[model samples]
Target chain A: MLKKERQALIIKQINLHNKVLSSDLSLTLNVSEDTVRRDLHELAQENKIIKVHGGALSKSYNVTSQQSDTYAYEEKNIIALKTISLIKEGMTILTSGGTTMRAIARALPSNLKATFITMSPLIALELIEHPNLEVILLGGKLSNDSKISVGGEVVNRINEIKADLCILGINGLDFDGITDSDWEIVQVKKAIINASRVVIASTISEKLNSALRLKVCNLKEVDYLITELPSDSPTLLAFKEKVNHIL
Target chain B: MLKKERQALIIKQINLHNKVLSSDLSLTLNVSEDTVRRDLHELAQENKIIKVHGGALSKSYNVTSQQSDTYAYEEKNIIALKTISLIKEGMTILTSGGTTMRAIARALPSNLKATFITMSPLIALELIEHPNLEVILLGGKLSNDSKISVGGEVVNRINEIKADLCILGINGLDFDGITDSDWEIVQVKKAIINASRVVIASTISEKLNSALRLKVCNLKEVDYLITELPSDSPTLLAFKEKVNHIL
Candidate 1:
């Protein structure tokens, strides 16, 4: 077998079983144990796997895949399903990156057709998985901490596209306004809100009424508020008075 | 433990073994078999693993990690090493996306400081792993097949930067000049060539003398031609005559 194919298979094996004996990999791949050890060593160097005395262990998966089991996974899933009700066919959508937004992307119907624009390469990759979605990735200096595109270049690109709706995954939301920790992301979010006709801010209930250092937009600018909580719940009563819709 | 943490641990365990018995997981995690089974089911639904009658297996590893084992793996490693020799600390580098460039990124010295720019998100992510490197991702319409940003936006961004070197992984090269099949990528490469002071074309020796449908640049435009073959080898004789440096 080709080395690439063999190593790929070995990775699959390790991921599936959580551990793999070098002897077994050699037996399965029909390569010498020396070759298997060498493959493990290379994979280890890549940070893809951990090499032990007799076998290898998979590196813990990254956050993208780990999103499914993230904190408040159930709540996020609820918001994801609820947010889907607001999206319609043939809409141009702008999105911010977060686990909550990813949940909404995952819950999207396979047949839904839309154009998705985002500064997050990871989110762009996820959005493209939907067959009917056209994904445009806005590029600029990639923030090492946020993994999202930033700078005046990205903001300029956002101004060129008049999106039908904007789905913002915000860090903080309160009667004062939407807020976030990073200044660059806040700038990008400000552009997204202005480029779209309507804005929907999605956050977990725990984040409601919370504020951060950098302000994004006023609570009045957000046309819709989405959370896992029931629309009629007392927790949302104050927000419901400010936003057009709460779900 | 949080379900996210538990599931992440479960994923790590499954990745290590390539297959894990449900009963074994229950004992190791100190959870009921039912909980283990539920965890396995949720992971399966996410397409993270394959559920079998008795256990689960991992999806094969992706192309980035598999680059080490890719076609002409050894040859690419040689090219990668040679390419590193051309790099000096504190230079601004522009790179095209491919296994060869990734190999070079992997081989970079830990202490080297450089600003790397690219239209590939995958490359940007890989480049950021190097502590001293600043990664700029040029964004535009992401081509589904190539996974590289294309369109006027990316080209405009390239025009704004004066890079010290452009390391391109090309599809074809001949006495006729550099050729590729994709027009969008060709456009991006043309901009890369115009923006950089020096251009290094790296490819496996086997790709030499080949031609694709679209043209990228003339043979003389490339300052350096890098192949796995030794510079004095008979195969490089023709290319050595046109390019200033053959490595």
Candidate 2:
């Protein structure tokens, strides 16, 4: 099994029993004890679990809980909160998978009706709780870390879809260009941008001046920028000239 | 034995008996006491269980807050359990949308690698949890009650592929024929039956000798009929004569 698959199962087991032994996980996942231990260690680093001696215990809330349990960072929460206002009822959306996008999924009202097309399996699960919403999960080879779909199949599927807006997550952004580290992610993001009428980049201000190896798009391509900082913040002045709207 | 398997056993033992010794595990799993001790130590770190003097304590292990709301009817559970034997590791199965099919989706092993074609959006979400399972959701106009897809698009999609088995959930069944209440449902069920080699009808024994307004298929066409009652029961004898197999 893939590492992401193993990790997802581990998270599921921990949430159910609230505690899991490394030995038990090894047995259930049909993996080596050492691999289970490494998974526990990584989850611990992500603040999703606390590594104990014989087994691991889940964090305060289940990892699967939509909004409250995960994405508690101050700035990400601020960006997530502001992005909700941009999405109106009955709009079709294309969302890339990331922590910030997850926040938006959690904050969505249960009664709201909308169509959401996403490549991330984890994000699809998070958004599946909305009773009135329609969730379309694009299938392809699953990426281990980002937990999103990548490769040619995903791009082909996205090409056939056109949405009202695309909510994108970025690795870094600057006057030079918006960038992401992973090549496959850059490809998928580019398709998402093309499939939607408008592109909204969801990010914190800390990523403003940094640049990654791959250029995703130019600054002028972004229709709206949602951030925690006020629209009039001096830090956003340079961003304003390149984007149509900043919130 | 893998360390994770050993650790899982230890946790299970503790849950069942309230405590377990490291020496006992080493003897049972053919591992060293030091390894068992290390496992216990790690589980303790996560607060999943308490590393006691010789073994471990339950340590909030019984708190099953993470459990999804399932396991409602004993009859449904029995049918779901029996259906597992029919599925192979890599077989593609077409699952009809309903409560009983959801149970089968929930019971699928995490390691089982198979393609599941489901028309229900809700079942798609449930089956998506299995890491190795490839879910092909047949999207079309949604039915409010069953939450499965209906109409021309769904029929067109199912016509293009053949599956090893089709797990059908019925509203009613009788010696005369299998039936459903909705016209669209009957149409979809007919297409699903045509798209698979094997047809397995899952129902409570109470639904026997009952007929709804619309006909799905004849009793002679059913490959398997699964219910809560024993196969030898006179209640199922009539069904046995028509179906290819029963359990």
Query: DockQ, in order, for the candidates?
Result: 0.20, 0.10
lDDT digits (tens) for residues B168-238 of candidate 2: 99889998879999999898999999999999998878888999999999988889998888899999987
Q: How does residue A35 of candidate 2 score in lDDT?
A: 91
Steric clashes per prediction: 17, 24
Model 1 alpha-carbon drift over 4 Å, by segment: A1-74, A130-132, B1-75, B106-110, B230-234
Candidate 2 Cα misplacement greater than 4 A, ranges: A1-69, A73-77, A97-99, A109-157, A169-188, A204-216, A229-242, B1-69, B73-75, B125-131, B141-145, B149-151, B181-185, B206-213
Q: What lDDT tens digits, residue by residue, belong to model 2 across residues A94-200?
A: 99988888878888878888898887755676677777888776655555445566788789889999999899987689897788877899999999999999899
**TM-score, per-candidate, Cα-based:** 0.73, 0.64
